[model samples]
Target: MSHNVLITGGSGYLGGDLLARMGAANLPPYRKLYASVRTAEQADGVRQYGAEPLFFNLKDESEIRTTVIDREITVVFYLIDAVQYEPPLFFIQALSEVKKATGRTVHFLHTTGAKLFSSHADAPTDRPLLDTDPQLYEIQKSQNPKLNVAREGVRTNCAVVEQAEKYGVRGYVFVPCIVYGKSKGFGEPVSTLRQIYMIVRAAKTLGRVYRVDSARPEWPVCHIADNTAAYIELLRKILTDENPSHGKNGYYLASSGSIAWDDLYDAIAAALVKRGVIADGSVTLASEKNVEDMGTALGVPKEMVPVQLGGKCTLSARRAREELGWKPAYPAEHILEAADGEVEWVLEHLRD
Candidate 1:
């Protein structure tokens, strides 16, 4: 079977991992693998991994549809956040139209974070959400977050699946947690974990870090390399496996562990203290005043602290393991080990 893969956000951490892994001959052979990048510099980034870089502005839905249709690209891995929803909606709509005009199944895997049934604030627990679990998957949108853009991402995946059922456009959704790792190809920071940047900055500015809610909110997390492997495994199966291209079979989770963002902050603070930058090796939590004053110095706004370090959100990868034989090599028990590498990278790049 001939396959041509097109990955959006190829210059990004996850996509760069895919590109580098492909370059390393990790995934099955494809006729061509093109990485869609916006800038010339971004294009150069993917070129190192031997991907044919395609420069196309994704905001223009017509352009995106044209490129997909023109190239006859069989598979697409969309890593961009649906913070901008219209382009993605339009892109999927065009694929649906293509299926209507000519019967061709284009497999699309979209990345949406595991904030779907989250901000389930009033009730917090140690139980991790499983994709096989109906409760979480059943609730698509939530009224919890006033500005719930992530909910819209889930809706987008739903719409794409509906189109697949109606017009035969194959679609899948991948929900990943806070991904940690420096990219193998470009060494770019995983932008999803803004907490890493904030914590490091807090340590630098105040010689310590702050934690709220006692630093014990379990949150879903994954290493960059492991998450990338899950993506590739799913991509490989979508093409070769007998899997249908809609609904839960099309959805996956890419998390191996959970740790409170507060705990992660503690590690960062301890690292700084051990380096003699901070006076003590402990986390401090003053009033919101501390965050407000340090916000100016550290570029972290005070009001955003609570939202960034909110309630616990855990996920289970059981279905991915049972179905695709995927397991996160770096489980929650070992997140600190990965954090050691991450802290070293953050200190060298972010705090420097």
Candidate 2:
């Protein structure tokens, strides 16, 4: 069946990269491409990439249904921040309806973060957690994150899978780790880089870089291009009806490998010191008061400071490699090598 695809968050870092690369992806034949947009300028922005801009209230179930059913969008790539269940449920149900009406398969790829499978969310940190593990869904279902927001995110991941299964739609949980490097899109091409940004913000306030965790914890990392490539590969599989794994086993982590958080902190610190953003390049352990000050700088609660900047997330990438034949062009330590450029770009674009 010819498939029409809709990509939401088309102006975001990941979404914009997807649109930017779509022209060169050499993807399998599909009917049409649509990008969810909010303004005339954004609509024009997506049009540059050969996408029909779709304007609809994602929160309104009826509007979402109308938009999807009318456009006959058989595939959706949801890249927006979705810690709640309602929006994704709306899309899944709408896609299921499309499947029923036309007797064609529909797919939903929900973009979630690596944090949902991290220590912050109470995911196991004792070993490398493979995305292809048969028990991954159950593990996600059992997570009781200490942070209320993270807990919601974990639940949302489970809800997407369960709801998609109930509605007979293919669901994929696309996980992007600590993705770095510059974006290649027409819109705002900067990643939020929340963790790195927090460190910089806190350092500026405290005059030095501070370590949120004493024992260096590791987290998965990915380059922007490699991350976008993984998404494209999965889309290729779907378009070709390869059935690249869906439902509970559809978790795809787009990461080269894992890196120590301390290594990242040190690299950024060196760059910041060279630019005089921080007085000292040396990384120091965060005292209680330091944590509080950092929280104030970040405008988050003190308890959430570590959750934002530190903690181990050993969620490994296996499914993307084994199933989609995806490989990262950048290695695990490439983020460290690119830290100088990353700091320069981030400093230029970061706003208070």
Q: Tell me the tens digit of each residue's lDDT in model 1 across 1-352.
A: 5566788887776777777886553566667778888888888888888778897878887788887777767677888764455665656666666555556566777777765535533222455557666544344532234444544555665665565556455777787777777777563664534556656666677667777554466677788788888887787776674463345456677877677766777677777776776787777664677767656655546655554545567566666777778877887656666666766777767643
- Where does the lowest 10-residue lDDT sum fall in candidate 1? 116-125
Colliding residue pairs in candidate 2:
none
Off by over 4 Å in 1: 97-102, 120-127, 148-166, 187-193, 294-301
Model 2, range 1-352, lDDT digits (tens) per residue? 4899999988888899989998999999999999999999999989999999999987889999999999889999999875877899999999999999998899999999998999999999998899999999999999998888898899899999999999999999999988887778767656664577677777777888889898989999999899999999999999999998999999999999999999999999999999988877999899999999999988989999998889999899999999899988999999999998888887887777
User: Per-model C-alpha lDDT, please?
Assistant: 0.67, 0.90
Q: Model 2, residue 121: displacement in angstroms?
A: 0.4
